[model samples]
Target: MSAVLDVVLSSAFLAAVLRVSTPYLLAAFGGLVAERAGVSNIALEGQMLSAACTGALVAGYSGSVALGALCGVGVATLLGLLLAALRLELGADVIIAGIGLNLLASGGTAYAVFTLLDDKGGTSGLKSGSLPAVPLPGIDSIPLLGDVISGQNMVTWLAFLTAPVIAWLFYRARFGFHLRAVGEMPDAAASVGIPVRRVQYTGLALSGALAGLAGVFLSMGYVSFFVRDMTAGRGFIALAAVFLGGLRPWGVFLAALGFGAAEALAVQLGTLDVPPQLVSTIPYAMTLVALAVYAWRRRRQAGVEVAASV
Candidate 1:
């Protein structure tokens, strides 16, 4: 009986880990697109924040989750375009622009919630219709594997499915070749008649749409309402995942799962006979450790490469 209980508990925790990792996967994908196009998209947090507010409000009003998600993505795209115009066209520094956007998101969302929805800090007790669950065909009958792969939110399924497609598009397609060229050497790409600014704009827009998907998952797939600054620094964590994953799709997936597992453990430990504060710090602590590990590996690899070159 004790062994059986242990197995069941482990499975439950694994499920929680997968659930928490979904957003990181999505945001990391977004970062992948932008960074691969030579644009540092530090504005993911702002874009997601805007999308969360839009998704919750639209869902609450129209009572249609799909429409709400569409609206959320639309808003994110517009913001992306705005940022592109400022950074690529108007010569603003991308990093500074991103910081400004994050600050705006933090303050603007709180004000909108209180002034518009009459909520103090969030859209509390509101029902934002949920995205439907998708069961992979024939997978639902495969016992444990079925449960793991099937019956996830639509957004979650999309996030998992899209990663490989994005990877292929980035590396295997003609357009992808162009994107890589822009990222690696913009001057050379421009000499060959490639419009670098256009590529950057497209990448930013795509990144914004992906971030919006993350916001929709938060409001509709995971919860019923939007809370103030609910993303909780997920954007920065996604940035870390992007770099730690070595800018590859599958690598990003693994990084996301690792962090998700840590977060799940933190939540579970909080329930045991442990210090609440210590349990709460576990996830962030894991993140710092993971980053340190990543840096060490990078340095080690660089040393090996230099030694081989010598």
Candidate 2:
């Protein structure tokens, strides 16, 4: 009885991990695109928050969850383009631009909620707004693996499916090569006829779109309404994932999964006889530890390479 219970319990935990990690995976992919093109996209928080509002408002009014999700992506793309214009073209500082965007999202969501929804702080009890889940056939009958791998939100599945594709695009494609070159050496890439500005603009735009989808997942799929600053600190956490994964798609995916597991565990443990405050910190604490491990390993590897060269 104990052995069977342990398997069941572990399976449940894995399912929770995958569900929680879905959002991080999307955000991490978005960040990866910009970073590979030499832009640090710290505005993920703002982009997601703004899109959440757009998705919730549109879905609530139009009664179409799909449309709301697309709208979220559209808004994110627009914001990304604006950031590109300021940072890549006008030479505005990326860090400052990110901060400004975050502020804009925080303020914009609140104002939109009040003005449009006639609500206080957020769009609570929103009606006719919900993203549907997708179910995988046959996979539901495979015991422990079944529940964890089947019947998830469309975006959740997309996040995983997109990982290998992103990896190939980054490492194997011509455009990927150009993006990497620009990041490593802008002057060298430009001299070779690559349009640095154009690449940066497109990269940032796509990053925004993916982040927007993440926002949609939060507002329409994860929950039924929009809340002010509901993205909380996920944007920053995704940034950590980028570094922790060493800018590699596979690494980042695993890192995102790790964070997701932490989140799932936190939620599960919260139901137990534990302090709410400590439980709340579980995900962030896990991220910090992961980051430290990544840094230490990277440094150790660098030392080994240096010794070999000597």
Candidate 3:
């Protein structure tokens, strides 16, 4: 109990949780956008990895984090557009195309990394410019809460703020209404001249941009260097968060935070007798538990609705 409390009470632990969760939060937001538009994007992993490597490579070589971020987001957005084009124009299945893109990204990113860094393993040795952390002005003067909130990466702050923006967009924005309309019933939406395809296309593009930002956060904010396959399937976890959150932005934020805390616990446990392998499973195990709970609640809600109707 003391050990756990020690870990929890440490300001560093809280900061680690925030940092670890940033990418997940960003990716989950992307998932929210994709699903809200009626197109379930499964290519999030590909987009993130592709953009991550590209962003890191650019930042390492050019020493311009901003330009690297643009390249990353642009590449990811283009990938999203390509998927949309494949689905909307070529009559391809979205899932299949997404899966194919993931496979392609694995190989493509590997090649890019090798070409840029002369190594297939990773680019951790590259002199990459990282995103700077912003210290809250006069925040340190406060006692407890200030320690937790101050000195976080600027991207982290932006990521937290993004949740409310997404929530607002879902409830208040005109685009949000169109997204729901197209997602719920494309035929109905199109009959009213809602331009369903255009909406989907735009939604996916936006999703890719968010995913790109997630990638940027991973390579440029969370760490100064890039590791091959560094995302380690967080994209899939974000998808789980999307479903677990019932596709709500704030809900996804909470879910992502849970996963991040689990990850932080795993890292903290590394100093203990726990096997490194077992400690690493904490995040994935939490994801499984979350999914189970989501399923149970969904079923319970459905049962309640049926009983009331009957």
Better of 1 and 3 by TM-score: 3
Kindly list the per-residue Cα lDDT of model 3 for residues 61-174, writing each as its tens digit: 888988888899889899889988988899899899998988898899899888877898988888878888888888866876578778888889888998999999989999
TM-score of each: 0.92, 0.93, 0.96
Off by over 4 Å in 1: 1-9, 136-142, 305-310
lDDT of 1 by residue, 42-79 (tens): 88888888888889988888888888899988887777
| Clash pairs detected, candidate 2 | none
What do the candidate models score in CA lDDT, each in turn? 0.82, 0.86, 0.88
Q: Pairing residues by index, what is the TM-score of model 1?
A: 0.92
Better of 1 and 2 by lDDT: 2
User: lDDT, candidate 3, residue 240?
Assistant: 95
Flag clash pairs in model 1.
none
In the range 1-310, model 2's lDDT, one tens digit per residue, is: 4543453388777777777788899998899999988989989999999999999999888889888889998999899899888897789999999999999999988988898878877878677377877877888889877888787777788888879989999989988899889988999999989999888888899899989988888888788888888888888898889889899999989888888877887777776666899989988898789889988999999999999999
Ranking under lDDT, best-scoring first?
A: 3, 2, 1
